[model samples]
Target: MTDLPAATAASSRPDGRASPGLRARLPFLIPLVVLAVVAAYFYVGLGRDPHVVPSVLINQPVPELALAPILGRDRGLTTADLKGEVSLLNVFGSWCVACRVEHPLLMAVAGQDLVPIHGVNWREPTPQAGPAWLARLGDPYTLVGADPDSRAAIALGVSGAPETFVIDRAGVIRYKHTGPITADDWERTLWPIIQKLRAE
Candidate 1:
């Protein structure tokens, strides 16, 4: 006896049970909409953006100026001193809360001993106060420069304290960071640049 063939169900219903072509395309649109929302989120409201200050003398020879004696040292600091080695110039003052916030980071930077740090005490109440403060905490700066009048700071184009500049052996300003340091900043921005400069 011959067996009857099995009947297959229709793929689509003739009574319009399936969606139209445009309705089928709607699911594919979801990913695009999500991506656009993410892009707008980053572009408009994200606070973790990288600082992008334009450098006037970056990669160029650092300007020359003499800073007054630091921590009551007899000899003064000069541009010539910054020419021979890779160093970090940290602008700070005893009165700046942000500067206090970065003191520990500066200490950690000192622990690395990769390069020396020079503190430019900008417009401070007293030069002795800085050394005293460091003495209370720890002195990360190998040499500190007193710019109580901000003459040296103005020459370096520094607008405020808690700003740091990485100077190369050629006396060029390489990298700069404003505001307090963050863990992500250390991992992403500061360390990488320091490593690059160290290699060169």
Candidate 2:
């Protein structure tokens, strides 16, 4: 039988020193490094920030908006529909989980008579889903507009559902809330702001 060659001292690390050939394997570490970078990128932008939400509407007129009037009703909600009252323009959809969670807060808003609440149903897959969702949840909206295309949402810089934009009687967006409204927030933050705007 032919004798086979054994690993030399250079190839084997007896004293805890890897060979030069093994050092070349370090390049494979790049993938792990890349994954960490990508994870960090997403983590940083995870939370909501009003700065990123286009501030163009702040202290500016509400963008011109027209949407399918109403689900089965004669009236529709629009900028024109928003006339003569300080109100809340709630951007939501029936399918949105956050919107569902915020339902109680909305009902609370209604109870307080803080302001008229109008809904802008954004990018609803179907009109039926939106109205049905509202009907099931006990509709709080004074009027609802079907925005299946989300054009109005884009114009408002609405990144997600359950956002509340406060519009003055003059129809300018004054304050915006970016996530589900909480009990404390409805009282301490939102209600106070709405009252201030109303007073002004």
Candidate 3:
């Protein structure tokens, strides 16, 4: 039988070399590259201070607040009550462990008579529980406003319990501090800001 022409051998590229098809699709990878960069940025940001949630309400007017009195309290609190002087508006709850953690510091601050400490009692199981908890823990607030529905808390942009806002004399929000305020946080950060706001 006549010999057939030698079969052509398939050419193979070197190892680690990409095929032309893959090279042609390189432009499709741009979006993935951008997504990876964005993901990396957020991952890095996650290591930052857990208590620092940047507030959009800073330097803005405090939201209109007219809340009913907490149970057993003679009077409720309002934004109007906060207008004449610099005050601390604290969002707290009976159920919040952090609120319990910060309670003593708040008492200390209240004892100093530096600023009037107002309360937004947020998401309590029963309205009376707030007053009861305060009665047991020693009430540190000048006035307590019941926010059982959390509508007022939402207006203030509260993420959770134990957040504090420093309001200026004109009822503008000057600063917001998330998480339970520690003694160091009070002495170093919050007290200074409150003093500065009072001076303004």
Candidate 4:
């Protein structure tokens, strides 16, 4: 039989000596590089304090919400209620264990009367439960508002229970605390911010 042309190295694979073109290998390398970048991003993120989630609502006006009073005797709370003075707007739920954990600190702060402490009773199983919980825990809120459907919570960009926002005299959100505010956090972080906002 007539000899066919010798197969070039580019077409030969059995010897496993030929290098693959950059284009042929790029697809495989790209995913590995992307995965490595993502892993490094998560590694850096994991080292960060999990409690500190940045809030986009900072320096913006508080969300407008006209919420019913959680307790019968208290007036309903609104965004307008947050105006005229610096206040702490706390988002809590009767079912939140962390909220209960932070209750004493809130009570202590409220007792000091350093600033008005408002409440958004977010996603409580029942409206009545919010009042009872507050009553049992010694209601720390100056005005407690029920957010049964979480509409107000959503508007305020609440991620979960026990978050707190510092609102300025103009009803702007000055800062946000993402987790349970412990006595240490209150003294170290929240109290200082509250003091500064009050002065302004």
Candidate 5:
């Protein structure tokens, strides 16, 4: 009592607890550092190109694709149909706005008869929904199939509508495009890949 230690005097509160201000072990700082690290990680991630979607289907044989034809189409799609020619199999839905965005490009591809363009009408609300949408927009598919329950879509590893697969003449899946195709995409990437596949 006559002499309280100077170090203890400076560090203790009036109630005899160690003063938080004097303690370098700041319990409050852990969360702040964690928050800062998380923010930095997200900020760095934002700079990456979002269009790159990986698929296990690349270089693998196309999945079993027996599906009913969309309304007004004569024939359904089958795995055997995919063989004997290089083709583009587009997975689309009537409800997908992105498919609409990419439709004109597909129409152009079909109009030019560049190659066989097949359609997998994925997860349509009704059988007629795909047919009606195609009728209004103009059908561009060599063969169109309906996949209301996403059976074929899941086998093809489709994450969303407007995904396109580049299939080799042997019915192997060579490439998978995830989003709506632009003219630049066709010219720069898709067409080049198709041409290369055609050679092999």
Candidate 6:
């Protein structure tokens, strides 16, 4: 008689389901690792200000500017234009919402006659857009130029629209303010810097 096969041991649980092994558990661990990485990334990022970016152009002489005036305007902006006073060189664009947000404050600054504000209208799809937006917002710039190709903007180390530089009387860039200038930024920080520069 053939020997009866010894009863095989059950690999599965009494419930008839296979026991989960390391391979089965690995997939669950992957998401926890990913989540941990993401959470740590945000935790580090939360401590830094997004607007305080580094620039190679800070404290450097103003780059050469031969940009033409925006549409419907006569004088263009030149490096010569930035000399002989404390001024704001604001790089902006009509399409940039942040520029619009900062315009009223600029208008107020212009209204006060505190400093000469110059503008670089950056990368407009149509030349008319800059002129039109300025007309609606009311031009605060003493001199406004078109930077359709971003030559001047790149030289100025511009990362985005609505970047304002505080230039000293000698055509030197003293301070660079990235992003829109709020009332507090103007009053508490920039205005004081300008006052100090003006005294010098």
Better of 1 and 5 by lDDT: 5
* Model 6 misplacement above 4 A: 1-44
From the highest lDDT down, the ranking of the candidates is 6, 5, 3, 4, 2, 1
Q: For candidate 5, write residues 1-200 as lDDT tens digits.
A: 53887877787866888776725667778899999999999999899766665998899999888999888878999999999989999999989999999999999999999989999999988788999998899999999888999899999988788899999999999998888999999999999999998897
Count of steric clashes across candidates, in order: 0, 0, 0, 0, 0, 0
| Each prediction's TM-score versus the true structure | 0.71, 0.72, 0.77, 0.77, 0.77, 0.77
**Residue 95 error, candidate 6, Å:** 0.2
Q: Stretches of candidate 2 above 4 Å error?
A: 1-54
Per residue, candidate 1 scores C-alpha lDDT tens digits across 1-200 of 13423221233344537535677899999999999999998878576644545558678776786877776566656778787878888888888898888888889888988678887878878767877777888878877778888788888777766888888888889988887777678779887887788789
lDDT digits (tens) for residues 44-112 of candidate 3: 988898657699999999899999998888899887998999999999999999999999989988888
Q: Provide the lDDT at 25 for model 6.
A: 93
Better of 2 and 4 by lDDT: 4
The C-alpha lDDT values of all candidates are 0.78, 0.81, 0.88, 0.86, 0.91, 0.91
Q: For all the candidates, what are their Cα RMSDs to the real structure?
A: 6.5, 8.3, 7.2, 7.2, 6.6, 8.7
* Ten contiguous residues with the weakest lDDT in model 6: 1-10
Candidate 6, clashing residue pairs? none
**Model 3 Cα RMSD, Å?**
7.2
Model 3 ranges with Cα > 4 A deviation: 1-43, 49-52
Span of ten consecutive residues with least summed lDDT in model 1 = 1-10
lDDT of 2 by residue, 1-200 (tens): 13433564546555557666746878988999999999998788787464446556788888888877657766776688776788899999878898999998788778767688998988878768887887788888888888888899998888888888888888988988888888887888888888888788
